[model samples]
Target: MISVDGLGPTDYERADAARLTRLPQHDLLVMAGARFGDLAPWRHPEYLRAVAGLPEEQALAALFVLGRQVPEGSLPAPLLALLSHAKIVSVGSGLLSADYALVRLEGLTLLAAWRAAGREVGSYAPWVGTDTSTLCRLVAARRTARTALDLGCGTGALAMTAARNGARALAVDINPECLAATTFNAALNGLADRVAVRQADMAALDLGERFDLVISNPPFLPLRRGALGWLAGEGGPDGLDFVWAIVRQLPELLTERGEALVQFASFGDQRGPFCAAQLADELPGLGLSARMLLKPPTPPRWPAFAERDEQGNLAGDLGREYRAYVQSIGATHYHPCVLSLRPGDGGLTIGRYS
Candidate 1:
């Protein structure tokens, strides 16, 4: 048996490295079926056959089979598991390359398909899909948003929601492909005129204007020493670096009474109250007040191909250690929070705790 510890240097690094290595290169065409949950052979025989033949360690065969069989409407728990190990690759008609990210739409695999056949074919993900719906509901409940900005607007999900709710909107991202996709999604949803898409970074935007509501689902994962694909997920060593940066810049981007909704994970050692409290403490210096609309704890789970460390513990223990570190910094639990902020409200308030 491969003791989990023997496979690891650490969970994040191990998972990150596995993702990098497992990604199919140019010559190899890995077929993705449905979502990662569609793993049953009945749903994807070809993929299952391919998996059966490859060496088990060289390829995580079970995931390849199960991911393709998962149901359409439900979140693919198995696929999410695979993501902890393999970088998702999207394959479909007229496309045969890897994608930076993957989402599913009506049983079809949707991807930010940047490069195809040595050419850049516009990026795309299901903009109006379930994920969009969930995000839209969150923004619509905010009554104070007269003007809204969607930072890192991959496919204009939040921007469309803002427009639908009567807010003048601007959608921003660093990827031109993402900007184009946002435009396409906006037009498809019949909200094109109300939402404007632009290429800009959250930290370096120059809109020359502030908003009553600013929402972002920024990249918040910690990247390994030399790895890069979608920087959206990596949040630096403690996973709060990007969130801290955004919080610091938010006051200047908001109207005096403006509020912003930002989604972030409390990952690694940065898991609890320390992360929230630190934000609370820092916001005052930036001249802002914050209200956390949602904060839900998420316990650590096993990742695909996860291994163990020399300490006879799962490699993911490093993440737990980091979580503990964050707790010591004042964090209390592993909660994902959506914070609403206004200018100069010295302390952070919890609007809803789940």
Candidate 2:
């Protein structure tokens, strides 16, 4: 048996050296008469059912996408060599076991360094979640920038996407594993020269340079203290800790005519939106202007805000503690939206998104 560790920059490099990225990538997994996006495929019965047949392609998906054990012959020779050299997958009994998950996004294959479900959020490379994908699409639709910054860059999806669109990118995260994962991804996607990784807390960040575009899908979930399974979701009482930190840095982080795109949830009470209205008062004072592309408000999901056990089981009633904390803070609802900021006279605008 070939023992391997979880993914890191070196693992990605080994894959690249083996020319793994040269292979055709699959973005969708078809199973049980249904097609599914690449969100934790191992948990879905549809994916497990598809993997049972062991078709060459789906078997390949089983190795990388589902992080399941696959037959030795499932992938090409080069991939086999890559897997062995990188020690990212274990080989035993003619089967290979991968501990990471890779998914396609914006024409690039992004890999998430695997950690068990109950691990600390920062201990592994984050998979591209809905907010990350939404922000990536928004950035891709916008004009390309000469330079870009992705704060709290989770697997460097946004930065890699920006590089794919013709920009040199700086991918920042507080987690070393995240930085390593981003580094590996940049090289895997052949964007290493265009993408750089940095480890720094966003609250104390000081790159001393501005970018034409800055993007983030920051942690914005509101939760009670000590109720978080992941450090990324440490949004404090109102879930605006990171949001406020990023907003406070915006005036200094963008060049003239440069824009910062942030995806976050804006809390609201009887008065109005929390961050939205607060920005109206603060952005102008900081010589910045803002526009919020608002989506319909949604109640916070109960499971997301509660703590979980090592086995990934919820520790308490479905968000019972979380909901009480939210009510205590006077926030009745939250709007998921992307806030656009630019250097200009103080002004705040709101627009609806479908």
Global lDDT of each model?
0.53, 0.70
How well does candidate 1 score on lDDT at residue 256?
79
Scanning candidate 2 in windows of ten residues, the lowest lDDT window is 25-34
The regions of model 1 sitting more than 4 angstroms off are 1-134, 224-226, 267-271, 301-333, 351-354
TM-score of each: 0.58, 0.80
Residue 212, candidate 2: Cα error in Å is: 0.6
Off by over 4 Å in 2: 1-25, 29-59, 71-81, 84-87, 91-95, 113-124, 224-226, 269-272, 303-305, 308-321
How do the residues 1-354 of candidate 1 rate in per-residue lDDT, one tens digit apiece? 001112223332423333323423211222222233321222445544554565532222222222332222122334333332333433345222233323322221223342211112333221223333345567878766788999888666687778877888999987665676565445434566788877677777678899988888765543331123343444654566667767788867899788787876664333344466677768768888787755556553222112446754346655465445555545444555677777875688776643
Clashes of each: 36, 1
Distance (Å) between predicted and true CA of 74, model 2?
A: 5.4
